[model samples]
Target: MLLSGHCLIVLERTVLAASPAEGCALLIGRRHAEALWVQRIWPCCNRWEPASERQRHFQLDPREQLLAQRWVRERGLQVLGAAHSHPSSPAVPSLSDRERSLGPTLLLIRSGLTDDPHPLRAWWLPEPAALPGPAPEALPLPLEAPLTGDLGE
Candidate 1:
């Protein structure tokens, strides 16, 4: 996937600011050929129950998701997928993440509160039925930078 320069910055700042809680956002963009180009970052609230688990888990607010879907539809864009931060773990998908993922979609994770070696990563989760067994395996995907646009919309 190719992220607009602005999207990347917004993602970084959002995740950084959400230190104690997991920051979440919806990726809005259009697909061309096999690549998804991110045009905007629609920030969302993490509404996981039991505030104590906020650090290790995140639930994207359903209301925000519905609103995002409507907003993107109006702009001829798609809700590509989602992004979230991992306060203390690496950027890779955790066991719960793999099991919870509704696949054939993109999932971006930002690890650590600070700039760790692998602060950010993306994964492609396949459709559950497509898997050979019960195990959920997420394939790593690249997060690329586009050639222009440093400011976000």
Candidate 2:
């Protein structure tokens, strides 16, 4: 149900390992009138690797891509969108990010130290068309630990 303003959507181990330090994006699909929801999370690729001193780019490996596609197809879920993280930069897509975007996909960018022992700032990528039409608005998804403290660890 569009879990807005929340980081790390509490996924299974399979999904988490696929996207550890980089970042992950998923397209969630649900029936129009049902509570059941399914997601296909994929790792965002860092095309600008090397050029950014190994700090500016993050790209999905081939294996992750294959798994993402398979997850969507097997689950019969329509890829609603994609997501990723900034690691050090803000949780917003850079110019290169826009250039590499696919369609009207939902992109999630996480920012902060992954091992800092604290939550990080997470934002949703606004629809490309929404950029020029009006002030870009991003959905803030803060990461909070569940009460159970079971972050799939």
Task: Count clashing residue pairs per candidate.
Answer: 0, 8
Q: Model 2 has how many clashing residue pairs?
A: 8
Q: How much is the lDDT of residue 151 in candidate 1?
A: 46
User: Candidate 1 local accuracy as lDDT?
Assistant: 0.79
* Candidate 2 residue-wise lDDT, 1-153, digit = tens: 243222245332223343334545554555445232333344344443553443555555556566767777787776555555555666556776665566455555555545544233323345565554432456544323334544354
- Give residue 54's lDDT in candidate 2 (0 to 100): 32
lDDT of each: 0.79, 0.48
For residues 1-153, could you state the per-residue lDDT of candidate 1 as single tens digits? 777666888987777677778998988899898888878888988898898898988888999999999999899999888899998888877767766667777788898746677687777677756554454444444446554643435
Error of 1 at 39 (Å): 1.1
**Candidate 2 residue runs with Cα over 4 Å from true position:** 4-28, 31-53, 113-135, 140-152
TM-score of predicted structure 1: 0.84
lDDT, model 2: 0.48
Index of the highest-lDDT prediction: 1
